[model samples]
Target: MRRYGPAVLLLLTGAAILRISLLSELYLRYVQAGLRPYLVVSGFLLVLLGVAAAVAGRREQEPHGAHGGHHAPRIAWLLALPALALLLFPPPALGSYSAGREAAQRAAQGVGAFPALPAGGPVALTLAEFSSRAIYDSGRSLTGRTVRLTGFVTRDDDGTWYVTRLLVSCCAADATTNKVEIRGADAPPADAWVTVTGTWHPKGSLGTDGAWPPVLDAASVRRVAQPANPYERR
Candidate 1:
C-alpha cells in the first residue's frame, strides 16, 4: 500500500475529474461541449494507467538496507500535484472576476449578416450572438428590434457597466468576453444575473478589433438567479 500510494492517488484523481465533469460543474471550466468525449477518454486512460502502475508497484519488493531507512522511487509523486490542487480548489465557471481580469475584448466576429431572429415576440439571443451583431454587423440586425438578453453584470472602473457572458473555445484558458454597454438604468451588482429587455442604441458604433461592444438602450432589467447552465457556446 505504501509503494502504491501515488498510483492509488492518481486513480482517485482521474475518477474525481471524470465524476465531476459528468455529474457536476467540472465540465464548465474546461472545453466546449464537443470535447466531452475527449475528456471521458482521457479520464478512462488515466484510470487505466493508475491501476496498471499499482499492480506493478505491488509486485516489486525494494531491497531493504541495514541503515533501517526505507527507500522507494517517488517519481510518480509529481502527478498528484494537479489532482490535489483540483480537489482542494476546483476551478470555477467563468464570471465577473474572469471578465475583469481578461482583456476588455477579443477579435471581432467575421463581418457578415446574422441569421434572422426566430419568429415570436422579442427574440432571445445569447450574449455571444448579440455581441457579434453589435460589433461586427454594425447592429444592423438589431436595429429597431426589441430583444431579450441575459447575463451577469460587470462594471468598469469608470462606473460604466455591461451585460456580459463568456465564450469558451476550448477551456477557461481561452475564454473571452461578450459584453454590451448597458444604458437607461443602474446596472445590478456585479455577478448578479439579469434579463434585459431592450433595443440596440441607435447611436452605437461598431469598433475596431472588438474594442467597443455596442450599447443597449434597456427598456427594463429584471434580476434573476443564476441559471444551471451559466456558460454558452459562441
Candidate 2:
C-alpha cells in the first residue's frame, strides 16, 4: 500500500473531481458552469495518469534493500484524506459566512438608463441585477415594479439582515458579495435560502455611498431550496 501511495492519491483526487463535475451538478457550487468540461477533462487525465503510474510501479523491479533503507513518507498518505473527504462528503456551496465576511464594496458605475422592465407581474431578478439597478439606474427602473430575488440570509452585527448572493467571475475563490437589505420581512436563519418579492425602497442619491447595498420592502418572503448554481455570474 505504501509503495502505491502516489497512485492512490492521484486516483482518489481524480475520482472526487469526477464525482462532482461529471456525475452531478455539485461542481456549480465552486465554479462557473462553463468550466465543467475542463474539470471533466482534468479528472479524466488524472485518472489515466494514476493508472499508468500504478502499472509502471508494479512492473519496475526494486533492489532487495530498497524498501529497508528508505520508506515512503507517512505524510504522503495523509494527503489522500482530503480527496477521500471530498469524494464521500463534498463541501456545501458558499453561504452566509462567506457573505458576512465581505464588506459592502459596490463597483462604481455611472448612473444611466436601464432597459424597461417587462410589463405586468413580478419579475425575477438575480441579486446582482437588482443591486445594480437600484443603485445606478437613473431611470429608477425598479420603482413601482415588483421584483423577486432569491438568496441566502446573512445578518450584520447591528441585527440588520440581507438576502445575499455571491458573484463569481471564475470560481468561488474569486466570489464577491451582493446583497439587498430587506426592510419589511423578518430574516430567515443564517444561510437559509429564500425568495423575496418586493418593490425597491429607494434611499439616498443614485451612484453614491448612501445608495449602496440597495433595499427592498419585501411583501412576501418564502423559504426555498438552494439553487443548483448558487453563485451568480459576474
Candidate 3:
C-alpha cells in the first residue's frame, strides 16, 4: 500500500477535478435532485480522504511491520480504476443523448448578455454565447453577418445537423445544451468537434410551438478533435 499510495492519491485528485469539471453536468441532469447535495459532499469527502490516506501511508512507511508484511501497500493501486474510467469515457456532451430530457429544468436561466461587437467584423461566438445573447437582445445584433463558431455535432428536426456546444456550470451534472445550424458541403460525423465559419440567418419567426429560431448557414466546416478543455465557456 505504501508504494502505490501516492499514485492512488493522484488518481483521486484527478477524479475530483474531472468530477468538478466535465462530469458535473451529467450528474446535474440525470441524478435525482435530492441526491445532488450528497454527491457533492461525498466528492469533497473523497478528496479529503485521499489526501489523508496518502499522508497516513507515508507515515506508516517509516515504521517497520506496520502492515505485518515485508511488502509495501499493494491495495492502494486498486483505487486508480475509477479515475482511469473518468479519463477514458467522459460523460457525453448534452446532445441528442439528452434531447428528450426536460429543457427548462436542465437549462441555465439568464446567462447574461454578450458584449456588443464593433461595426464590420466577423462575429465569433460559441453556441452558448450566441444563445444567451440572442435571448437577451432578440438576435437584432447578430443579423446579416458572417460568424465563426465551434462545437460538437447535434441534429435538429428535419435532419439538419448542428454544430453544438455545451455550457457546463459544474460537471455533466449542470450543462446547458445549445446548438447552431451548420450549412455547407460535406456533413461531418456526429459529435466531431469542428470550427465553422458561416452567416447567421434567422430561420424566420420562431418555429411552431416556440422552437428555437435561426440557424447559422455554414460557409465552411473544418473538423477538429475534442479540445483539451471541452466545455464552451467557464
Q: What does each candidate score in C-alpha RMSD?
A: 3.3, 1.4, 8.3
Name the top lDDT candidate.
2
Candidate 2's residue-wise lDDT over 1-234, tens digit each? 555777888999999999999999999999999999999999999899899889988987766655552444576788889999999999999998888788887756788999998999699999989988999999988989999999999998888999999999999999899999999877788999999999999998998889888999999999999989999997
The alpha-carbon lDDT assigned to residue 14 of candidate 2 equals 94
- What's model 3's overall lDDT? 0.60
| Per-residue alpha-carbon lDDT of candidate 3 for residues 51-124, written as tens digits (9 for 90 to 100) | 77676667664765565744434555656666666545545445555533525322345433355666775677
Candidate lDDT values, in order: 0.76, 0.90, 0.60
Weakest ten-residue segment in model 3 by summed lDDT: 204-213
Candidate 2, which ten residues in sequence have the lowest lDDT sum?
64-73
Full candidate order by lDDT, most accurate first: 2, 1, 3
lDDT (Cα, 0-100) at 164 in candidate 3: 70
Look at candidate 1 and tell me the lDDT of residue 93.
Answer: 69
Kindly give the number of clashing pairs for every candidate. Answer: 0, 0, 18
Quantify how close model 2 is to the true structure by its C-alpha RMSD in Å.
1.4
